[model samples]
Target: MHEQESTRLGDEIVRLVRMGARFRGMFKTGDLGAEFSALMLLPPLRAMGPMRVTDLAEFKQADPSTVSRQAAQLVKAGLARREADPADGRASRLAVTEAGVQACERVREARAAMLERALADWPAERITAFTDLFEEFNHAVEALLRTDPTTPPREPA
Candidate 1:
């Protein structure tokens, strides 16, 4: 890409991210409450089964303290539980509860429905093309973040 095109793309990505955050805030699941920040931790915990705060922080490229606080919220909400780490009796790992799984599904369905309504006028082929391109863009960004030592850890915007 040319320098100008790269600059434009970067700007658009920033705008898209900001808009997405706003849209996410609009989604309210009864199980998780209206605060989406803490709920973000559920997906990784759900996927990884159980993980220490530090491990989850590293996986998410977020601060360990932040992850710890979020995990606590999950625990308080009964969406997740802390369990003894099999390898280390002294340490505990956070695991998503069955409620957490259901909450995640609800959130996913809500988001999908919203997207479907928003894209109702778009052709199926266009939607598929956009999805493919968006996934490619996300993978490229992840690769850059992984390889670039100078890249800073992500924080809530």
Candidate 2:
């Protein structure tokens, strides 16, 4: 990429990261009363039905031990349940409970509503195009995270 293009992308990425941190803090401290770290597990569990800690860890690119602790917290909060994997006598899968699903839905709706308000001035076509591009960008990021040497060394900020 050209230097100017790369710099603009880096700046945009940093801004997005900062905005995400702000939103996370807002949700964690508000009426929801759930920590962002723990709430993060709900979406994957909701989507995947049930998953082992190792499976979640891989999917999240997180450490197994960390995911284990998060899973324990989720279970303790009654948001998730651990059940023996019938196919594997010794292993277990963590599944989101009804409460977990509701919580996830509430959070998702809140996020969507907020974004809708933020983008209310934009035309429908622009919003659709942005969504499509953002999804593609996220998949590119995931691929980069999974592989070796996806990009050149970063220039100092």
Candidate 3:
């Protein structure tokens, strides 16, 4: 094996290890038990605009009924709502409400606080670079998956 290839793989391993540790620390802070389905739903809803329940199921790689149930819970909690879809009269799209947006912001702020505490000793430049690189990686992976779902470039050998 090439020495350079070995070093690159080692760097990626280190990054993954650090990321897992940071996520563990964040979860430890919110005694919200082991279930954080609400938190998980928040980011995806924030990223994707209003979508039909079926669409949400597809995006989440989940069953339609599960997605519908979760989305219904979100609506009942006032975090999300069902709106008539203009394109399809018989269907509805689930969208986060104003209150939902506020809730999302709060959750994000708390997570950011956790991250800040974890990386307090790191230089600002290093943190910024890490964020940039992570987003770039996310984009690359998203593109790869969209192009071919059968195989992603980052899968383990």
What are the Cα lDDT values of the candidates? Answer: 0.83, 0.80, 0.71
**Candidate 2 global CA lDDT score:** 0.80
Q: Deviation in angstroms for 12 in model 2?
A: 1.1
Question: Compared with the true structure, what per-residue lDDT tens digits does model 3 show for residues 31-147?
Answer: 332124544565678788788877777676666776777777778778788889999988889888877777677667777887888799999999999999889977876677778
Angstrom error of the Cα, residue 137, model 2: value is 1.2
Which residue runs of candidate 1 sit more than 4 Å off their true CA positions? 154-157
RMSD of each: 1.8, 4.2, 5.0
**Candidate 1 versus the native: TM-score?**
0.90
lDDT of 2 at 147: 76
Q: Which of 2 and 3 is ahead in TM-score?
A: 2
**TM of each candidate vs. truth:** 0.90, 0.86, 0.68
User: lDDT: which candidate is best?
Assistant: 1
For model 1, residues 75-124, the per-residue Cα lDDT tens digits are 88888899999999999999989988888788888888889988999999
- List ranges where model 3 is wrong by over 4 Å: 1-35, 43-49, 58-65, 152-157
Tell me the tens digit of each residue's lDDT in model 2 across 46-131. 99889998898877777778788888888887889999998897999999989888888878877787788789999999999999
**Model 1 whole-model lDDT (C-alpha atoms):** 0.83
**Worst lDDT 10-window in candidate 1:** 26-35
Superposition TM-score, candidate 3 onto the true structure = 0.68
User: Residue 132 CA error for candidate 2 (Å)?
Assistant: 0.9
